[model samples]
Target: MSFFSRRKLSEQELNNYQQQLNEFKYKITKFEDRLDKLQNDLECKSQGEPLQGVNVINAEEAANRVEKAAQKALPHELKEAFDEINSAVENEQQSVRLFQYELGAYVCANGKPQRKRIYHIDALSKKLKKYGYETKLDSNGPNSFLEVSWKGKETSDISKIDPAKKYVLPLEDTECEITDSATGKAISYEVAYACPRDDKWRIIYDRKICSDAVIVPGKEIIDVPKWVRSIEPIEVDY
Candidate 1:
Protein backbone atom coordinates (compact mmCIF):
# COMPACT_ATOMS: atom_id res chain seq x y z
CA MET A 1 0.00 0.00 0.00
CA SER A 2 1.18 3.55 -0.67
CA PHE A 3 2.34 5.60 2.31
CA PHE A 4 -0.49 8.07 1.75
CA SER A 5 -3.94 6.82 0.78
CA ARG A 6 -5.03 9.78 -1.36
CA ARG A 7 -8.76 9.64 -0.72
CA LYS A 8 -10.48 13.01 -0.47
CA LEU A 9 -12.85 13.62 2.48
CA SER A 10 -16.41 12.60 1.48
CA GLU A 11 -19.11 15.30 1.26
CA GLN A 12 -21.17 13.56 3.98
CA GLU A 13 -18.15 13.41 6.35
CA LEU A 14 -17.40 17.10 5.62
CA ASN A 15 -21.03 17.98 6.28
CA ASN A 16 -20.98 15.99 9.55
CA TYR A 17 -17.86 17.88 10.71
CA GLN A 18 -19.44 21.21 9.77
CA GLN A 19 -22.63 20.28 11.63
CA GLN A 20 -20.72 19.24 14.73
CA LEU A 21 -18.70 22.49 14.66
CA ASN A 22 -21.89 24.50 14.28
CA GLU A 23 -23.55 22.64 17.16
CA PHE A 24 -20.50 23.18 19.37
CA LYS A 25 -20.49 26.88 18.51
CA TYR A 26 -24.17 27.11 19.34
CA LYS A 27 -23.56 25.44 22.69
CA ILE A 28 -20.71 27.85 23.43
CA THR A 29 -22.93 30.81 22.60
CA LYS A 30 -25.70 29.43 24.82
CA PHE A 31 -23.23 28.90 27.70
CA GLU A 32 -21.84 32.43 27.35
CA ASP A 33 -25.34 33.86 27.34
CA ARG A 34 -26.15 31.84 30.44
CA LEU A 35 -22.98 33.05 32.14
CA ASP A 36 -23.70 36.64 31.32
CA LYS A 37 -27.28 36.33 32.50
CA LEU A 38 -26.16 34.63 35.71
CA GLN A 39 -23.71 37.43 36.49
CA ASN A 40 -26.34 40.06 35.78
CA ASP A 41 -28.98 38.21 37.76
CA LEU A 42 -26.60 37.84 40.70
CA GLU A 43 -25.83 41.55 40.55
CA CYS A 44 -29.52 42.43 40.35
CA LYS A 45 -30.44 40.09 43.17
CA SER A 46 -27.60 41.39 45.31
CA GLN A 47 -28.80 44.92 44.72
CA GLY A 48 -32.45 43.92 45.23
CA GLU A 49 -31.57 42.51 48.68
CA PRO A 50 -31.71 39.12 50.40
CA LEU A 51 -33.74 36.12 49.25
CA GLN A 52 -37.06 35.42 50.98
CA GLY A 53 -35.86 32.46 53.04
CA VAL A 54 -32.49 33.83 54.08
CA ASN A 55 -32.36 35.04 57.67
CA VAL A 56 -29.37 37.26 58.03
CA ILE A 57 -27.85 36.73 61.46
CA ASN A 58 -26.68 40.20 62.41
CA ALA A 59 -22.91 40.83 62.38
CA GLU A 60 -23.07 42.27 65.93
CA GLU A 61 -24.57 39.05 67.36
CA ALA A 62 -22.11 36.88 65.42
CA ALA A 63 -19.15 38.92 66.66
CA ASN A 64 -20.44 38.82 70.23
CA ARG A 65 -20.63 35.02 70.04
CA VAL A 66 -17.03 34.85 68.82
CA GLU A 67 -15.90 37.12 71.67
CA LYS A 68 -17.70 34.94 74.22
CA ALA A 69 -16.08 31.81 72.85
CA ALA A 70 -12.67 33.47 73.02
CA GLN A 71 -13.12 34.19 76.76
CA LYS A 72 -13.82 30.51 77.55
CA ALA A 73 -10.88 28.46 78.91
CA LEU A 74 -11.28 25.61 76.44
CA PRO A 75 -12.68 27.77 73.68
CA HIS A 76 -11.65 25.73 70.66
CA GLU A 77 -12.71 22.33 71.99
CA LEU A 78 -15.96 23.59 73.48
CA LYS A 79 -16.92 25.55 70.37
CA GLU A 80 -16.24 22.62 68.04
CA ALA A 81 -18.21 20.16 70.15
CA PHE A 82 -21.01 22.67 70.60
CA ASP A 83 -21.16 23.29 66.87
CA GLU A 84 -21.26 19.54 66.13
CA ILE A 85 -24.03 18.90 68.65
CA ASN A 86 -26.03 21.87 67.41
CA SER A 87 -25.64 20.73 63.80
CA ALA A 88 -26.77 17.21 64.72
CA VAL A 89 -29.92 18.54 66.38
CA GLU A 90 -30.75 20.79 63.42
CA ASN A 91 -30.57 17.86 61.01
CA GLU A 92 -32.10 15.21 63.28
CA GLN A 93 -34.73 17.28 65.10
CA GLN A 94 -35.82 14.44 67.41
CA SER A 95 -35.16 16.56 70.52
CA VAL A 96 -31.39 16.16 71.05
CA ARG A 97 -31.34 12.58 72.29
CA LEU A 98 -27.79 11.20 72.53
CA PHE A 99 -26.74 7.53 72.22
CA GLN A 100 -23.51 5.62 71.61
CA TYR A 101 -22.46 3.13 68.91
CA GLU A 102 -20.05 0.25 69.59
CA LEU A 103 -17.30 0.08 66.98
CA GLY A 104 -14.96 -2.63 68.34
CA ALA A 105 -15.33 -6.18 67.04
CA TYR A 106 -17.73 -4.89 64.36
CA VAL A 107 -18.40 -6.73 61.10
CA CYS A 108 -19.80 -6.11 57.63
CA ALA A 109 -22.88 -7.82 56.19
CA ASN A 110 -23.61 -8.39 52.51
CA GLY A 111 -21.70 -5.57 50.78
CA LYS A 112 -21.94 -2.84 53.49
CA PRO A 113 -20.28 -2.28 56.87
CA GLN A 114 -22.22 -2.61 60.13
CA ARG A 115 -21.62 -2.62 63.88
CA LYS A 116 -23.21 -5.98 64.54
CA ARG A 117 -24.98 -8.57 62.41
CA ILE A 118 -28.32 -6.97 63.36
CA TYR A 119 -28.50 -3.22 64.31
CA HIS A 120 -28.58 -1.95 60.72
CA ILE A 121 -27.50 1.71 60.98
CA ASP A 122 -26.16 1.82 57.41
CA ALA A 123 -29.68 2.99 56.62
CA LEU A 124 -29.14 6.25 58.53
CA SER A 125 -26.67 7.50 55.94
CA LYS A 126 -29.23 7.05 53.21
CA LYS A 127 -31.89 8.98 55.10
CA LEU A 128 -29.57 11.85 56.06
CA LYS A 129 -28.59 12.19 52.43
CA LYS A 130 -32.26 12.59 51.51
CA TYR A 131 -32.77 15.30 54.15
CA GLY A 132 -29.80 17.34 52.79
CA TYR A 133 -26.82 16.29 54.89
CA GLU A 134 -23.10 16.02 54.32
CA THR A 135 -19.92 17.14 56.16
CA LYS A 136 -18.88 14.42 58.58
CA LEU A 137 -19.15 10.68 59.30
CA ASP A 138 -18.50 9.98 62.96
CA SER A 139 -17.27 6.44 63.48
CA ASN A 140 -20.45 4.69 64.71
CA GLY A 141 -19.22 2.03 67.10
CA PRO A 142 -16.67 1.04 69.79
CA ASN A 143 -14.42 4.07 70.44
CA SER A 144 -16.64 6.09 68.07
CA PHE A 145 -20.00 6.14 66.34
CA LEU A 146 -22.06 7.85 63.68
CA GLU A 147 -23.22 10.93 65.58
CA VAL A 148 -26.98 11.16 66.16
CA SER A 149 -28.86 13.27 63.55
CA TRP A 150 -32.35 14.77 63.14
CA LYS A 151 -35.36 12.50 62.90
CA GLY A 152 -38.05 14.46 61.05
CA LYS A 153 -40.85 14.59 63.62
CA GLU A 154 -43.25 12.63 61.42
CA THR A 155 -44.12 8.93 61.42
CA SER A 156 -42.14 7.76 58.41
CA ASP A 157 -44.20 4.91 56.94
CA ILE A 158 -41.63 2.50 58.36
CA SER A 159 -42.77 -0.88 59.64
CA LYS A 160 -41.73 -2.72 62.78
CA ILE A 161 -37.93 -2.77 62.68
CA ASP A 162 -36.84 -6.29 61.62
CA PRO A 163 -34.26 -7.99 63.86
CA ALA A 164 -32.53 -10.15 61.26
CA LYS A 165 -32.23 -7.90 58.19
CA LYS A 166 -32.00 -4.36 59.64
CA TYR A 167 -28.53 -2.86 59.22
CA VAL A 168 -26.48 -3.27 62.38
CA LEU A 169 -25.74 -0.61 65.04
CA PRO A 170 -23.73 -0.76 68.23
CA LEU A 171 -25.95 -2.06 70.99
CA GLU A 172 -26.17 0.20 74.04
CA ASP A 173 -24.21 -2.02 76.41
CA THR A 174 -25.46 -0.06 79.43
CA GLU A 175 -28.27 2.37 80.22
CA CYS A 176 -28.13 5.86 78.69
CA GLU A 177 -29.90 9.06 79.77
CA ILE A 178 -32.57 10.76 77.63
CA THR A 179 -33.57 13.98 79.38
CA ASP A 180 -36.99 15.55 79.07
CA SER A 181 -37.31 19.19 77.96
CA ALA A 182 -40.11 20.16 80.37
CA THR A 183 -38.89 19.68 83.91
CA GLY A 184 -38.87 22.94 85.91
CA LYS A 185 -42.65 23.41 86.14
CA ALA A 186 -45.45 22.87 88.70
CA ILE A 187 -45.44 19.18 87.87
CA SER A 188 -41.84 18.03 88.13
CA TYR A 189 -40.74 15.84 85.21
CA GLU A 190 -37.57 13.87 85.88
CA VAL A 191 -34.75 13.15 83.42
CA ALA A 192 -35.61 9.84 81.76
CA TYR A 193 -33.24 6.91 81.31
CA ALA A 194 -33.94 4.19 78.77
CA CYS A 195 -32.29 0.84 78.05
CA PRO A 196 -32.35 -1.83 75.35
CA ARG A 197 -32.09 0.92 72.73
CA ASP A 198 -33.26 -0.87 69.58
CA ASP A 199 -36.27 1.05 68.26
CA LYS A 200 -34.48 3.95 66.55
CA TRP A 201 -32.86 4.69 63.20
CA ARG A 202 -30.12 7.05 61.89
CA ILE A 203 -28.86 8.05 58.43
CA ILE A 204 -25.07 8.11 58.14
CA TYR A 205 -22.42 8.37 55.41
CA ASP A 206 -18.85 7.04 55.12
CA ARG A 207 -17.20 10.44 55.70
CA LYS A 208 -17.49 14.07 54.65
CA ILE A 209 -17.80 13.97 50.87
CA CYS A 210 -20.08 15.40 48.17
CA SER A 211 -21.06 11.95 46.79
CA ASP A 212 -20.96 8.30 47.86
CA ALA A 213 -22.54 4.87 47.23
CA VAL A 214 -24.40 4.56 50.56
CA ILE A 215 -26.62 7.66 50.31
CA VAL A 216 -27.51 7.40 46.61
CA PRO A 217 -31.16 8.29 45.91
CA GLY A 218 -33.63 5.71 44.59
CA LYS A 219 -35.81 5.85 41.46
CA GLU A 220 -39.17 6.59 43.08
CA ILE A 221 -37.81 8.26 46.28
CA ILE A 222 -40.42 6.07 48.02
CA ASP A 223 -38.34 2.93 47.40
CA VAL A 224 -35.76 4.79 49.53
CA PRO A 225 -37.50 3.98 52.84
CA LYS A 226 -37.04 0.28 52.11
CA TRP A 227 -33.32 0.51 51.30
CA VAL A 228 -31.95 3.72 52.94
CA ARG A 229 -33.72 3.47 56.32
CA SER A 230 -33.41 3.41 60.12
CA ILE A 231 -34.11 1.23 63.19
CA GLU A 232 -33.99 4.01 65.74
CA PRO A 233 -36.11 6.15 63.39
CA ILE A 234 -36.19 9.29 65.55
CA GLU A 235 -33.84 9.43 68.50
CA VAL A 236 -30.64 7.65 69.48
CA ASP A 237 -31.05 4.19 71.05
CA TYR A 238 -28.01 2.41 69.62
Candidate 2:
Protein backbone atom coordinates (compact mmCIF):
# COMPACT_ATOMS: atom_id res chain seq x y z
CA MET A 1 0.00 0.00 0.00
CA SER A 2 1.13 3.60 -0.60
CA PHE A 3 2.46 5.57 2.40
CA PHE A 4 -0.54 7.96 2.29
CA SER A 5 -3.01 5.07 2.16
CA ARG A 6 -1.38 3.37 5.17
CA ARG A 7 -1.37 6.59 7.15
CA LYS A 8 -5.06 7.19 6.35
CA LEU A 9 -5.99 3.69 7.55
CA SER A 10 -3.99 4.20 10.76
CA GLU A 11 -5.79 7.48 11.43
CA GLN A 12 -9.18 5.82 10.96
CA GLU A 13 -8.23 3.04 13.37
CA LEU A 14 -7.07 5.57 15.95
CA ASN A 15 -10.33 7.48 15.68
CA ASN A 16 -12.35 4.29 16.22
CA TYR A 17 -10.27 3.40 19.29
CA GLN A 18 -10.75 6.88 20.73
CA GLN A 19 -14.52 6.64 20.24
CA GLN A 20 -14.62 3.31 22.02
CA LEU A 21 -12.59 4.73 24.91
CA ASN A 22 -15.01 7.66 25.25
CA GLU A 23 -17.97 5.26 25.36
CA PHE A 24 -16.28 3.21 28.05
CA LYS A 25 -15.65 6.34 30.08
CA TYR A 26 -19.31 7.34 29.81
CA LYS A 27 -20.47 3.92 31.06
CA ILE A 28 -17.98 4.01 33.95
CA THR A 29 -19.24 7.44 35.01
CA LYS A 30 -22.83 6.22 35.00
CA PHE A 31 -21.88 3.17 37.06
CA GLU A 32 -20.06 5.37 39.56
CA ASP A 33 -23.09 7.62 39.99
CA ARG A 34 -25.39 4.64 40.69
CA LEU A 35 -22.90 3.23 43.15
CA ASP A 36 -22.58 6.53 45.00
CA LYS A 37 -26.34 6.86 45.26
CA LEU A 38 -26.70 3.37 46.69
CA GLN A 39 -23.94 4.04 49.19
CA ASN A 40 -25.61 7.25 50.31
CA ASP A 41 -28.90 5.44 50.82
CA LEU A 42 -27.20 2.74 52.85
CA GLU A 43 -25.32 5.23 55.02
CA CYS A 44 -28.47 7.16 55.83
CA LYS A 45 -30.37 3.99 56.61
CA SER A 46 -27.59 2.74 58.90
CA GLN A 47 -27.65 5.91 60.97
CA GLY A 48 -31.18 5.00 62.17
CA GLU A 49 -32.36 8.46 61.18
CA PRO A 50 -35.83 8.72 59.74
CA LEU A 51 -35.52 8.25 55.98
CA GLN A 52 -37.62 10.57 53.81
CA GLY A 53 -40.25 9.23 51.48
CA VAL A 54 -39.92 9.62 47.72
CA ASN A 55 -42.87 11.37 46.15
CA VAL A 56 -44.67 9.65 43.29
CA ILE A 57 -47.61 10.80 41.20
CA ASN A 58 -50.93 9.08 41.64
CA ALA A 59 -50.86 5.72 39.89
CA GLU A 60 -54.32 6.38 38.52
CA GLU A 61 -53.13 9.48 36.67
CA ALA A 62 -50.21 7.66 35.10
CA ALA A 63 -52.42 4.74 34.00
CA ASN A 64 -55.03 7.12 32.57
CA ARG A 65 -52.45 8.80 30.37
CA VAL A 66 -51.36 5.44 29.07
CA GLU A 67 -54.95 4.36 28.34
CA LYS A 68 -55.72 7.53 26.42
CA ALA A 69 -52.59 7.17 24.34
CA ALA A 70 -53.41 3.56 23.55
CA GLN A 71 -56.97 4.42 22.63
CA LYS A 72 -55.75 7.09 20.25
CA ALA A 73 -53.08 4.98 18.60
CA LEU A 74 -55.09 1.79 18.13
CA PRO A 75 -57.57 1.42 15.24
CA HIS A 76 -61.29 1.80 15.74
CA GLU A 77 -61.78 -1.93 15.23
CA LEU A 78 -59.52 -2.58 18.22
CA LYS A 79 -61.59 -0.37 20.56
CA GLU A 80 -63.36 -3.25 22.27
CA ALA A 81 -60.22 -5.39 22.66
CA PHE A 82 -58.10 -2.43 23.71
CA ASP A 83 -60.67 -1.46 26.29
CA GLU A 84 -60.38 -4.86 27.92
CA ILE A 85 -56.59 -4.62 28.11
CA ASN A 86 -56.80 -1.02 29.32
CA SER A 87 -59.23 -2.01 32.03
CA ALA A 88 -56.82 -4.66 33.28
CA VAL A 89 -54.03 -2.09 33.32
CA GLU A 90 -56.17 0.37 35.25
CA ASN A 91 -57.20 -2.31 37.71
CA GLU A 92 -53.57 -3.19 38.30
CA GLN A 93 -52.70 0.46 38.80
CA GLN A 94 -55.55 0.98 41.22
CA SER A 95 -54.41 -2.03 43.19
CA VAL A 96 -50.75 -0.99 43.40
CA ARG A 97 -49.23 -1.27 46.92
CA LEU A 98 -46.67 1.00 48.54
CA PHE A 99 -44.68 0.41 51.69
CA GLN A 100 -42.48 2.76 53.76
CA TYR A 101 -40.46 0.11 55.54
CA GLU A 102 -36.73 -0.71 55.03
CA LEU A 103 -35.65 2.98 54.99
CA GLY A 104 -37.23 3.55 51.56
CA ALA A 105 -40.54 3.47 49.76
CA TYR A 106 -41.45 0.21 48.06
CA VAL A 107 -43.87 0.14 45.14
CA CYS A 108 -45.36 -3.13 43.98
CA ALA A 109 -47.55 -4.14 41.03
CA ASN A 110 -48.54 -7.73 40.45
CA GLY A 111 -48.13 -9.12 36.98
CA LYS A 112 -49.57 -12.18 35.28
CA PRO A 113 -48.73 -15.24 37.37
CA GLN A 114 -44.98 -15.31 38.16
CA ARG A 115 -44.14 -11.96 36.60
CA LYS A 116 -44.27 -8.72 38.63
CA ARG A 117 -44.14 -5.50 36.66
CA ILE A 118 -41.67 -2.90 38.00
CA TYR A 119 -41.53 -0.52 35.04
CA HIS A 120 -43.89 1.90 36.78
CA ILE A 121 -41.25 2.70 39.39
CA ASP A 122 -38.67 3.36 36.70
CA ALA A 123 -41.09 5.72 35.01
CA LEU A 124 -41.75 7.34 38.36
CA SER A 125 -38.02 7.90 38.84
CA LYS A 126 -37.66 9.68 35.49
CA LYS A 127 -40.70 11.88 36.18
CA LEU A 128 -39.34 12.82 39.60
CA LYS A 129 -35.93 13.65 38.12
CA LYS A 130 -37.59 16.00 35.66
CA TYR A 131 -38.96 17.95 38.60
CA GLY A 132 -35.49 18.19 40.23
CA TYR A 133 -36.02 15.24 42.54
CA GLU A 134 -33.04 12.89 42.71
CA THR A 135 -34.24 9.31 42.50
CA LYS A 136 -32.62 5.88 42.56
CA LEU A 137 -34.13 2.42 42.10
CA ASP A 138 -33.80 0.30 45.19
CA SER A 139 -33.97 -3.41 44.36
CA ASN A 140 -31.89 -4.30 47.42
CA GLY A 141 -34.94 -5.65 49.23
CA PRO A 142 -37.51 -7.90 47.65
CA ASN A 143 -40.36 -5.60 48.71
CA SER A 144 -38.93 -2.12 48.02
CA PHE A 145 -37.92 -1.07 44.54
CA LEU A 146 -37.38 2.72 44.67
CA GLU A 147 -35.42 5.21 46.76
CA VAL A 148 -36.12 8.90 46.29
CA SER A 149 -34.18 11.85 47.67
CA TRP A 150 -32.90 15.31 46.77
CA LYS A 151 -29.51 15.98 45.20
CA GLY A 152 -28.02 17.14 48.49
CA LYS A 153 -30.41 15.69 51.04
CA GLU A 154 -30.38 11.91 51.19
CA THR A 155 -33.30 11.90 53.62
CA SER A 156 -35.70 14.45 52.24
CA ASP A 157 -39.33 14.11 53.26
CA ILE A 158 -41.53 12.81 50.44
CA SER A 159 -45.27 12.41 50.67
CA LYS A 160 -46.09 8.71 50.57
CA ILE A 161 -49.08 7.77 48.42
CA ASP A 162 -50.61 4.37 48.95
CA PRO A 163 -50.92 2.19 45.87
CA ALA A 164 -54.47 1.15 44.97
CA LYS A 165 -55.52 -2.27 46.27
CA LYS A 166 -53.32 -5.04 44.88
CA TYR A 167 -55.02 -6.20 41.67
CA VAL A 168 -54.04 -9.37 39.80
CA LEU A 169 -55.57 -11.21 36.86
CA PRO A 170 -55.54 -14.99 36.64
CA LEU A 171 -53.31 -16.62 34.02
CA GLU A 172 -55.40 -19.74 33.42
CA ASP A 173 -57.45 -17.69 30.95
CA THR A 174 -55.57 -16.38 27.93
CA GLU A 175 -55.93 -12.88 26.55
CA CYS A 176 -54.96 -13.74 22.95
CA GLU A 177 -54.14 -16.80 20.90
CA ILE A 178 -51.82 -17.21 17.93
CA THR A 179 -50.82 -20.04 15.65
CA ASP A 180 -47.24 -20.50 14.47
CA SER A 181 -47.25 -20.58 10.68
CA ALA A 182 -44.14 -22.74 10.57
CA THR A 183 -45.52 -25.47 12.85
CA GLY A 184 -49.27 -24.86 12.57
CA LYS A 185 -49.49 -25.24 16.34
CA ALA A 186 -51.76 -22.89 18.24
CA ILE A 187 -50.73 -21.41 21.60
CA SER A 188 -52.27 -19.12 24.15
CA TYR A 189 -50.36 -15.85 24.52
CA GLU A 190 -50.25 -13.07 27.05
CA VAL A 191 -50.40 -9.59 25.60
CA ALA A 192 -48.23 -7.02 27.35
CA TYR A 193 -48.18 -3.44 26.08
CA ALA A 194 -46.46 -0.29 27.22
CA CYS A 195 -46.33 3.37 26.23
CA PRO A 196 -43.20 5.08 27.36
CA ARG A 197 -42.22 8.77 27.45
CA ASP A 198 -41.44 8.56 23.72
CA ASP A 199 -45.18 8.17 23.01
CA LYS A 200 -44.76 4.90 21.14
CA TRP A 201 -46.44 1.59 21.71
CA ARG A 202 -44.34 -1.37 22.71
CA ILE A 203 -46.21 -4.64 22.55
CA ILE A 204 -45.12 -8.18 23.29
CA TYR A 205 -46.61 -11.67 23.17
CA ASP A 206 -45.41 -14.12 25.75
CA ARG A 207 -46.67 -17.49 26.96
CA LYS A 208 -46.60 -16.78 30.71
CA ILE A 209 -42.89 -17.63 30.58
CA CYS A 210 -40.20 -15.08 29.80
CA SER A 211 -39.69 -16.39 26.27
CA ASP A 212 -41.30 -14.25 23.56
CA ALA A 213 -43.71 -16.08 21.26
CA VAL A 214 -44.37 -15.50 17.59
CA ILE A 215 -46.25 -12.30 16.68
CA VAL A 216 -46.85 -10.56 13.35
CA PRO A 217 -48.31 -7.05 13.32
CA GLY A 218 -50.85 -5.89 10.77
CA LYS A 219 -54.21 -4.13 10.58
CA GLU A 220 -55.69 -7.25 12.10
CA ILE A 221 -54.04 -10.11 13.95
CA ILE A 222 -55.47 -12.56 11.40
CA ASP A 223 -54.04 -10.48 8.56
CA VAL A 224 -50.51 -11.01 9.90
CA PRO A 225 -48.23 -13.92 9.01
CA LYS A 226 -48.76 -15.85 12.21
CA TRP A 227 -52.53 -15.66 12.13
CA VAL A 228 -54.10 -14.85 15.48
CA ARG A 229 -57.16 -17.08 15.56
CA SER A 230 -58.92 -15.54 18.55
CA ILE A 231 -58.50 -12.97 21.31
CA GLU A 232 -60.06 -13.13 24.76
CA PRO A 233 -59.31 -10.39 27.24
CA ILE A 234 -58.71 -11.56 30.79
CA GLU A 235 -61.51 -10.73 33.19
CA VAL A 236 -60.15 -7.79 35.17
CA ASP A 237 -61.72 -6.56 38.39
CA TYR A 238 -62.69 -2.94 37.93
Winning candidate number (lDDT): 2
Which ten residues in a row are the worst by lDDT in model 2? 221-230
Error of 2 at 99 (Å): 43
lDDT of 2 by residue, 90-148 (tens): 44421122221323333232211122222334444444344343456665444655444
Q: How accurate is candidate 2 locally (lDDT)?
A: 0.33
Q: After superposition, how far is residue 216 of candidate 1 from its true place, in Å?
A: 54
Q: What tens digits encode model 1's per-residue C-alpha lDDT throughout 24-122? A: 335433443433344444555668755454334444654554344323212222223334544554464533222223334444433334333211223
Instruction: Tell me the TM-score of each prediction against the true structure.
Output: 0.20, 0.19
Report lDDT (Cα) of residue 171, candidate 2.
22
The models' CA-based lDDT, in order, is 0.32, 0.33
Angstrom error at residue 122, model 1: 49
Off by over 4 Å in 1: 1-6, 49-238
